[model samples]
Target: MHILLVEDDHKAARLLARGLEEEGFAVTVAHTAAEASSHAHAMWRFDMAILDWMLPAKDGVALCAEWRQAQHQLPVLMLTARDAVADRIVGLNTGADDYLTKPFAFDELLARIRALLRRAVRAQHGILQVADLTLDPATRAVNRAGERLDLTPKEYAILELLMRHTGAVVTRQQLAEHVWHADLIAIDNLMDVHLKNLRRKVDPAGLPTLITTVRGRGFLLAQPEGGDA
Candidate 1:
């Protein structure tokens, strides 16, 4: 649901971003390769990236190459003016997952985005159900032992994200990007509030806290004290 748009044409980029935003996507636009490079170097998290093949400093391919070198397996979608089979093949073989030519429809663009996101997500994209726990992405549902656990949308989102990245320490920024809306992004107590709420919901019995709050870093999902249930 988040994307990085690397296009030199500000107008075109704005229009594309607007369309994607309307469809409930968080978009960050980088008008120059330098800007994209800065973001990439800063470790800005994006579920997917859309790059213009024709760019200054470094073309899309070059930028993508750099990203791949640093952090491979990033889902990149390339946009170009050329429409040759060779060009598309080169783009894909380089690092891009999908390619869209100039004058492409917004619908197709959205579809491609979804497709790339889907492919990148693989087995880790959708709802997660383990034992009595039920985490549903679409409905934002969470249940334990067939008992429905009431959680606000934000709480549910955070819990689902934690489950998806179970056993790993998910930084606060990562949770912010995925669970919080743009308006709430500036809220200082965003993570603390939602996570405290989620803990109550998931650990009412004091059975064992699966959402472990790692001091100073972020959080992890597993039984409390690293003990087996």
Candidate 2:
């Protein structure tokens, strides 16, 4: 998964990046709020964001608010030195999915990241579909136009997010949020490559496209009536 880290501590940022990389996650580091803002705006889609409370210009809470204002639904985990109940409440209220205080065990941080991903992956509402595409959360099966579609973990997650929303628009940021677990790898054209691969696997020629781009908006997968083209 791709991650965007908004921490100013150089040593800590590099250290965390190394460890997370070992865990098979792609991570990107942002030292300040301005960097994070610019990075995210540049279509460097992140699955998750790790934000530090203290930054040069704006605090993590303010940056979190800014991301939300931009409709970035990616789960953000706030890492801060403050360890007060009120501070934790404020962090959560500010759109942080979880909080990790300084001097934290990296293991706990990793566990929290996994927990957040588990929450995102589940289908409390069960099956989701769009047109000929169908995803059975219980079976982990996907099918389209009477033909089954094979997907990797990341592809399945992407498709699941789209099917869950069906005809509703899902932006790249939203997709990143729903699919990204912990680390976001910078310098990788991961999302672009994956989307292209998914399209190829799911749609061959002459098939009324199931996954269609909404231009500047995002993407939508509409459920066709009775699987009709």
Candidate 3:
């Protein structure tokens, strides 16, 4: 898993990054909120983030709030010296999934990280159904009308995004960012090819098409007329 570690303490950040790397995780260290924000918004996808409450300027709580406001689903774990219940409540209220006080044991920190990751996995794995189509996020399985459909990784990612926003138009930019982790212009043709293939497989002969193209806007995955998604 990839983790973004935001800590202003140079020595502490290094040690934590080293330990996490040793534990087989890709770690990106940011010494300030600005740097952390850049990393978070970058192409590199991180599974989780560990943020220090105390920073040079903008604090971790504010950063976490910003991320939440922007609809970034990356899990955040806050680290701080404040051990009071009020402080913990404030952190959690501001979008921190969990909070760890300063001088915490390394082993405990690792355990907490593992727990948060597990919770995230479970949340992501909830079965998604849009009309006859069903997606199992855990197994990466896609089925329509009880028939299994083989899909490329990119195709599956695109379909998942569409299914999640069923009935609502999902822009090409959103698909490109989520599936390819790149700008739409960079992969416009590539996205078209994948979408075509996906439509061919999912909308086979005799089956009501679920995918729709909203001209000049994007794509929408929805059920047929008189049916709800």
Which candidate gets the maximum lDDT versus the true structure?
3
TM agreement with the true structure for every prediction: 0.80, 0.68, 0.67
Candidate 2 lDDT, 21-98, residue by residue in tens: 899887888899988888755433566788999999789999998888888888889999999999999999988999
Per-model clash counts, in order, read 0, 10, 0
- What is candidate 1's lDDT per residue for 142-211, written digit by digit as tens? 8876778988867876777778777789888777766653544485486787788788888777465577
Error of 2 at 212 (Å): 8.8
Q: Which candidate leads in TM-score?
A: 1
Model 2 misplacement above 4 A? 42-44, 123-128, 136-140, 145-148, 153-229
Tens digits of per-residue lDDT, candidate 3, 1-229, equal: 6688999999999999999989977787899999988865552367799999998889999999999998888889999999999999999999999999999999999999999988886888499988789998777889999999999988988898898788899999888766775678999999999999999999999988899899999999998887773
Candidate 1: worst-modelled 10 consecutive residues by lDDT: 179-188
Q: Give per-residue lDDT, candidate 3, residue 51.
A: 93
lDDT of each: 0.79, 0.80, 0.89
Which portions of model 3 show Cα errors greater than 4 Å? 1-31, 34-48, 65-74, 79-95, 99-115
Q: Cα deviation in Å at residue 111, candidate 3?
A: 7.9
